[model samples]
Target: MGNAVISSDKWHPVLDRCLTISGEEEEEAFQLLENLASFMLPYEISASPLLQQMWYIIDNTKYDGNDKRLKALSVLTELSMGSADKMQLLIDSNKNARQVLALLLCRGKFDVRQQVLVILRNMLINLPSSIPFLVERQTVIGVSDLLTVMHPDTVILALEAMKAILENGGSPMTPENNEPSFSLLAEEASVHSRLDFLVSSPNEHVALLAMEILHEYIDPNDDDIILPDDLIDLTLHPLS
Candidate 1:
């Protein structure tokens, strides 16, 4: 069915139905959209409208955070992370992935949020072009908020996103014409202070990621940069 010769015109009704779907119909509608994504990717159909519908379906809140909505979003997230071509199309169409990300980051249930994070991490890891779009979307604030959460997994996801931005020269310090405009937001959010507390996180990955970011971005002479003894010891004595 993914190979069907469906024109872009045909997808409009599907989007309309998805936007207005309810109850069991919602799940089937999402599944159909997911199936159509294969064809959509190969053709030049506008993906943003479909993405917008998915966001609405998820945001209705009338759904009361049901599994059906999550299922649809999971598929949408997967589609966003599908490939550079697909993601580029979404970007070109000016589809904002950040709204969907914000919903998952701020309010999604634990498992759903984790899935969203995985999708985000993969998107950043694979698509460097997405950095400006994300940074412009003020994603750093959301990533910083994740650091305050008690869950180490979420913290790791946040770290990975930051790392991607930093490594890709998406940092505030990056010298480029199109740098994201809200560099001050990171400082205002006190992201460094939150990361300082995570330096000694019980999770090794979390601790390491925190240290890596601090090492690169935070001034070594700054009074606020506190290194955990374990992290210091591990750094001083490698292979121990």
Candidate 2:
């Protein structure tokens, strides 16, 4: 289905239905959009009105119930996956895109927040330009809080996203090195403390990832760093 030669015009009806959908029809409309998004080319999706409609559904709080918002986020995640242009279009088309995503990260349900993290991670990976926008206070704090979630997958996603942000944003230049860094984000008390706590997580993969981020970005001079036995074993043997 991904290679099916569907004209751009074919998306119009679906876009129209999604744009005007309401009440009970909202779920069906989003479901249809999600299916279309899965196989649609990034350029085709960007050229159509689909992104705007999805943003409308996502930004409007009235669509929060009936799982409509989650569906919208799912569609977005699929659309933004491997295309830097699509990710850029989503950010450029909506001035408040970052804020809306931050709100979802902070207030949405577990699934919803997980979808948002996926979208942010995709953005950080595909579109380096999104770093400055996504690295702001609310977004950073929201991602930082996810480290404490009970779910390891969600925590891993958040950690990976933070790692990408730090890698791309880079730290400020010091006397030792001339290159800038994203240390400001890593240095945030909330984010730094969370990494410190996560370094000892029972999940060895989680602890290793957290430790890698700290080792690369964080100042090593901090006090009270505790290394767990699992981390020691994993560090020596490493995850295969």
Candidate 3:
């Protein structure tokens, strides 16, 4: 808990032990890694082997149980809350990370899916390059499914992720890569109707976020549709 800076000399051994141990000891090892990772700078952790090691644990679910994997995911989520470089490292370090996270979002338990959404939200906001990968993985569909969760915070997170996607959508990955934008994908997933319902949410924060997402869905060429100045200001500076 001290401000002492963590170095490779200190963390490398812990990383190794975290991967090699099992049972409660392994759980403690992962916990220790999480603590150490929190102390290390995002670039430091992303630059180290720890990132790949965590990815290994996350990708190879057979290597351990859900507890350890979730712990590993937590570490990644923490790392991703940093600069864009760190988020890019999380994706570039593992070829399967996006696919695995998307699959988890679609089929994993509620807690796991929530964690994946947080990570995806970070990626979409921080790393522009991740948009194509996420689009290719049909991440919007997975995100669209979370709008109905009873937890307002989780619902808000899902909406924020969708907002980020729409902000970056419609840009072709390349001249010939004809992948659909996230905006189109969301429409196909019936996210618009879902947002329409959420706009009437009892929680004002949730309702506002839903309205902001709906605003993003508007066509730029259509200038007749207008939002109130206060609503625009509130959306620009979210309560969160």
Among the numbered candidates, top TM-score falls to: 3
lDDT of 2 by residue, 172-227 (tens): 22212342345564466278888878888998788888887787667545554444
Cα lDDT tens digits for candidate 3, 162-224? 887888866434312465666777888888889889988998778878876676663444453
Candidate 2 root-mean-square deviation in Å: 6.1
Off by over 4 Å in 3: 1-5, 20-27, 41-43, 63-65, 171-178, 219-229, 232-240
Write down the TM-score for model 3.
Answer: 0.82
Candidate with top lDDT is 3
Per-candidate TM equals 0.67, 0.78, 0.82
Go through the candidates in order and give each one's C-alpha lDDT.
Answer: 0.62, 0.71, 0.73
lDDT of 3 at 4: 51
Q: What does the lDDT come to for candidate 3? A: 0.73
